[model samples]
Target chain A: MLPFVFEWQWDIGHGVFMGLFYLALTIVSLGVVAALAMTFYDLYSGKEVHEEGHGHEDPWADYSYAHDKADRGEYA
Target chain B: MDDSKFWPKGTTRCKPVHFGLWMLFCLALAGWALVSAFLCLYKGLNQTNMNDYFAFGVWIVVDLAIIALGAGAFFTGFMNYVLRREELKNIINAAVIIGFICYSGAIMMLGIDIGQPIRGWFGFWHANVHSMLTEVMFCITTYLIVLIVEFVPLILENRQINKVPDLHFFAHNLHTIMIVFAATGTFLSFFHQGSLGGMYGVLYARPFAARGGVLIWPWTFFLFILSAIAAGPSFTTSIVMITEIVTGKKLTTHKVKMLMAKVSGSLLLFYLVLKIADTLYWAFVQTPAMGLSPSVYYQAPYGTWLLIAELGIGGVLPCILLLSPQVRESYWILLLAMLLNCFGVTMNRFVMTIQSLAVPVLPFEKFYAYLPTWQEWGISAGVIAYGFIIFSLAYRYLPVFPQETKLNPTTD
Candidate 1:
């Protein structure tokens, strides 16, 4: 067991372990929340989202293509 | 009879009949697993070879091994999103899918291994904050959720699925903020991997498994983390290579594989150095301090050969081959090295879980050799079958390999 830390005290072990664990959970939950918020906003605002391989280009297409090119060693 | 519409754009798939046959094979294995699970649940723990002495058998070993192998998802995500290693984007999707398969499969195996499916939540409900297992349970389940969240974007990106405007915007938004999940995953994965090793390390009664350490964490804790990150990318790359061979298509560019190899080799090299030191210390100092010779821990069946194979052949040899620029360029050689690297980590897990328990602590107690029953083997095979089915489905329908179109250009 955590012999170095008292059970009641918020010692370094509990502080660091539980703190980081909760911090990670918060970040993940917040990310999902933000995505949901954005999705609803875009849907209600009547923004047109480009479907994959559709005539309209994907917003992330340029960045992804550049990454693909780089991975293929096409660019120095 | 065209399912091609559902396939990723510019990709070719086998005929439905051929894919169906493959699915049938995987389903057979799944059927076997179901029977085994039913027997184990109905007949109780007596259906398996596990006993009071060997509470952990093949299931635990496979669980540990796959979880370690699955480290690629988080590590790759961390690199691509957090470190801005954009080239990794080509392979990151595959890594995520593999991670999902591994984590979810592991949790399922644990559900059976725990012997009581109903009260399984007790571990979470009545939390033991002091135990390393609590940390592992919390992090693994939480990280699995993160992986699912990460995987959702890809699932939403499927050709047919992407057409829904709301889902499209949701996937896009998720992609934009993926760094947050990636960072969170990295944090969870790091701790769980370490806590698993720490669980073994903290077995103070089992001198074979116990180790001296800094603060609450043992050397095995850090070693587990290092080995997972090291072997993880290699396992992911190996799966990608196998998929390419099976499908007869180029999925990702060779450079992406090379980057993975480089990352794996560097981390592996770091891991090996410490692992060797840990072994040496355990053999010479730690074992003697416990009033037991290291040789006592390595009796017949768990002989010195296990150490030689784990460290020498599986560890050092793979490290050398992977780090060699000339050797890595050759496809088969690189694949062999990565497979060997994975074998090394799996062997390490086997040794930690099985061998540690096999050794007799008390003078009257005898060394117990454990062979898992058919039910155990079936369950293990089912995990592999599950992985194959999941990966196959993901690769077929999802836009898993971003570079797939460019790598194997179709001539119409």
Candidate 2:
């Protein structure tokens, strides 16, 4: 549905419909990527996590956020 | 309670033997459909009785019917995320699961309906940007992706599936951004539902289904969106109630069911008023303007009875019942009303698909009738069976109703 695609049209109908279409596709794809990255990072960082839904107790579970690579100076 | 090992925390399920028997029945249906599907594919559409007159047969009817029924997914999500109706959070997972089943099942059947599964992707590769059908194909395929995104977190949340930390974190992250997907779903759903109606409406030459509209969209377009939104929540509530009956457990609170019914009833009332107006205008104004009478539409095998059933029994009657506190207060009555409401919307689809084609625009042309071949029935029943199998599996493994544990502390 991209503009560069051969079938793309310059009219308002195609522009508006396809615009919203691609916008949604982009958002969902980005969300999936972010979730996958955070999951892998959390696993590698060895974050303390108690097993949930087993009716067990764990008050001292560790929670960590996936930090941005740029903020960690990866680009520098 | 031995299956408690697989059940969600603080909840109970039916005996596994009973569950297996239930699945075996559903699988038998699916197995029949699978054979029928292969016959359709290999032997071609000759396996069905469809012809030039009924190009869009039972399969399209099922497609429109289920997609409309499945609107509960987006509508419920819209309420929870966009409208922030926190109470809706309880039933949202079940809505998503049902939506997934309806849509994926529709797509699976549609693949065989086209009679060359290989060419199904042709719509995407060499798409027509201007065609309403192209819009429908793109939006439905995209929304199915969005539904998958919405449904995966639920699948991942299964007691066993979530044991993997990465999957757990992934599911949690997906939940955090669900608003994005929900809003996107609402956007895509609105168009595809409307476009499905638009497909019929654009047959301007066919006065039966065609109507005046705003801009490119016909009145049927808006009516479809309205009818779907009105019927969707009711369908979801009905499914939840049926599950409760079959399992002998209260999966959701009556309060939640009533809340959904109240919303459904209000929307249905709103839809009925407009639908009545649309029919009147189409019959009196539009049809007469085309030099045809409304009587031109009512033929043998399709009579004014269809319209009366769609509007009066299916629409107005259920609308009144669902709106009443007394009716909705009774669990059985509410379920019946929901069933009627669904019936009305499905009748609307059937009329649009079959009766529209049944009508003769030219006086020289004769009235027509269509009875789907066994192959068509086989495929259709298979779709229903697929929905049952998927939803059953989800209910057994996933925590579909968040309030299930709280509502039913113990089951005999």
Candidate 3:
């Protein structure tokens, strides 16, 4: 239950339940937001987003570089 | 008119006419679902056999089952991205599409099942935070959003769509950060899957479904999670195998399918051990404490055979078959084992939803039987049809199976 709702309470049950619920929501939302931010940066910076090279390249390589590149602002 | 350009590179699809016919058939089923949905919405819940005694019916059984089956997407993502089980990368896209279809379809069915579809958000608005259903509501809806986020990048990767500069960048960015979404999804899925079983387990009045548990969670909660992760990979693999059989092409390597089967079998074996222990305790200890014999729970139409089918034929048999090295190497045998694993989990949900309700709780109450009407069947058929159409389109157009081009190189 949202804290703003009339039925909402400040008890432990609502606290723990909605706490985890919102935490998950926040994480997912932030993930999407981060992607959007990265996308906008890539678009405006004249970076070329190539079609992923297929046929036996390490499939997990993209994910591996995401965070490291994000930290360095070099996602392109 | 040739759509070969749209096909994933190095892959071949059936002729357009043949694909069109398949789409038409799927659409017909969707039409029936639409009609069924319209009637249920216009005529109200009375269109089906559900009554006060049967508050949940076939729809809930299906909702729970597919959600369990769809766990493949999140679990597979978790394994691939988080655990770094790279072989799953070959099948992960297909898994995501299946998860999207399953969750979206189940939500639609729930919309119809609720009868008053407009008030569906009331579950969130006027929340009962203590209820397991409330948790299920929050987690399922939120996880569906995560699934959409996961699926969109794949859609953007469509051959023609990938040509767009901005869209290409967006999809690439999404893939770059997929681990975050995958972790979030795994968290959401774990709770919701458990809460589903916890909903039935907390029905203390219904001895058939109720169970003892660890602090703040029932045994069924853990069991449900275990069963889902066990069967989810198998269901995903089963779909891939079916796709191969229909297309006469190898979409993925044998190693990928075998890996999925092995994961499924190991998890299934763990689940069965706990499930059998839980069943034994429920029968000998928990049921008797409620002053009801386990025998009372298994009457005509809801007989002991359901237990055998669920646990024995579907459970242990599949576990053995899947875990066997020789069987895993044999394509058909592996698929059969996976199907049985999926069936076992579905049956677990069925009994939990339907049979649990069928068994009367009160001393004077009678054991009641429920049969869903044609409309109910129509709605269910519609969900299946929806899945078929979505999967067919994704397979035809998207690079769903990474190993596809490699496994089935075009000679020409």
Model 1 spans with C-alpha error above 4 angstroms: A1-21, A53-76
> Which pairs in model 3 have colliding backbones?
none
In order, candidate lDDTs are 0.88, 0.84, 0.89
**Each candidate's DockQ:** 0.26, 0.13, 0.24
Q: Judge the docking of candidate 3 as incorrect, acceptable, medium or high.
A: acceptable
Please write out the lDDT profile of model 1 over residues B124-218, one tens digit for every residue: 55557789998999899999999999999898888988989988999999988989899889989999999999999999999989987999899
Please give the fraction of native interface contacts (Cα pairs under 8 Å between A and B) kept by each candidate: 0.38, 0.27, 0.51
lDDT of 1: 0.88
Selected candidate, larger lDDT, 1 vs 2: 1
Candidate 3 per-residue lDDT, tens place, B1-412, comes to 7999988767789999999999999999999999999999998989999998999999999999999999999999999999999878888988999999999999999999988889998987787877998999999999999999999988888888888988888888898999999999999999999999898889988889988899979999999999999999999999999998999877776777888999999999999999999999999988878788988989989999999999999899999999998998888899999999999999999999999999988778898888999999999999999999999999999888876765565776
Q: What is the docking quality class of candidate 1? A: acceptable
The DockQ-based CAPRI class assigned to model 2 is incorrect
What would the per-residue lDDT of candidate 2 be over residues B127-231, giving only the tens digit for each residue?
677788888888888889999999898887778778888778888778878898999899889988999998888898678898888998988888999999999
lDDT of 1 at B101: 96
Chain A TM-score, candidate 3? 0.65
Clashing pairs in 2: none
lDDT per residue (tens digit) for residues A3-74 in model 2: 677876688877776677678789879888987887788788897554553222222121121111222334
